[model samples]
Target: MFAILIKIKAMRVLRITFFLFINAFYANAQYDFEKYPSIEYKDYDWETVKSDDGVTHKVIVPDFYINSESLILKINYYTEEAKDSEIYISGIKYKEDIPYTPIGLSSLRIADVNGDGLKDIKIISYYMGNGLASLNVKVIYFFQQANGGFIKIAYEDKMGDNRLERDFDGDGNFEIITMKIQGHKNHNYWLFNIYNFVNGKIENVNSKENYPIMVQILNRETFKITSKLSRQEMKQYQVNNLENYNN
Candidate 1:
């Protein structure tokens, strides 16, 4: 009789252990998109434009600022087939392709780079890898010319990294402000750097330290919080981060 009682106690303990394991696994499961509603913006129309090289490009023209000088277009093209991805900017073509692949690129800022009043283009690219799997997220930047051409600016391989075109130092020309991740641990911090374009060149300013990995430009001269580190908030965080850049 005592042996049977001992066996029953063991079985009860095993059942409790199994239940705890199941709950933990479910709690830590990868992010699900269905929980959030606002993030799923109905797909917008994509405009097809052909380049002189006989390549078909899918593009979308986002809304513009009132003082924008030139129209900015976000374009994507597959080199030979639809599998290998490539992105380009209308009006401004780079002398060469810039490294770093963005998941999506849109929302452009048009301003005069040299105070000529003719608009130049500044573009933001949201870089993220495949979802629900081992994903990667980063940002790529592009610039434009008064004659309506685009040039690559910078590329980063971590989430929340972005480019800002503003005269943060009261200078006449637009400066580039970017945030970068510097380490690889779970507690990795971010670094904010500033750059100025002189004679059509990009130079990095003083950059050191780590930030919260998420920031947003509220206006011409300020930034806002978009997200932080938490398992439940990742999807919302990514969606919010993407929307911030597009804006």
Candidate 2:
């Protein structure tokens, strides 16, 4: 009789949990996406910039850079001061205004980030407070268009221990691994944010994906991860894999 009673109680608990999950999902689904900001795009002549390079002295903020056969990036780097950068790709007549770069500039690279044949761009930059709690990390992506231009998307997360661009699954694709931490006074709640380019746009595709492969790769690579799961939790879980995440 006791066994039957325990089984009945277990079923009741499961039913309650199931209903709670369904209700939560419904509430989340009702949240309007219009409340959020759309993706940002940088308007410029990429063709000329792709084949240009040089140095110019500026009394103001300058386009300090890394050059490759396909692109000359002026990371628009600055710190402790507000400034604007004008990028004149070597001999090109056109100039584009790159936004004021953060003081937490980490690294930038060009590669086929979205699994597309064309090379894409990724930037990892972050700022922090005196303690572990104050983190403002940004992961930015510029998914290349077939016309040789790029679509820009930026995401924020707290855990940024692994700053290098890596294809954690070894499947010819790379993922932007970030995380979100909540709670007060170190009683933290973590959400793992896994991002990739899906159909020329950056999207979070955590569900319907093999997360273990990434965790295993990080373990093998010996990454120091604080927020174990990841960063921002989005409802639209995309499913795009990357390969050889490099520039």
Predicted model with the maximum TM-score? 2
| C-alpha RMSD by candidate, in order | 12.9, 16.5
Candidate 2 wrong stretches, greater than 4 Å: 1-68, 77-103, 163-171, 184-186, 210-247
Error of 2 at 16 (Å): 51
Q: Residue 130 in model 1: shift from native, Å?
A: 6.4
lDDT of 2 by residue, 138-205 (tens): 55566666664566665555645433334545555565655454443344433344565667555555
Q: At residue 203, what lDDT does model 2 achieve?
A: 56
| Separate clash counts for every candidate | 8, 17
Q: TM per model?
A: 0.42, 0.46
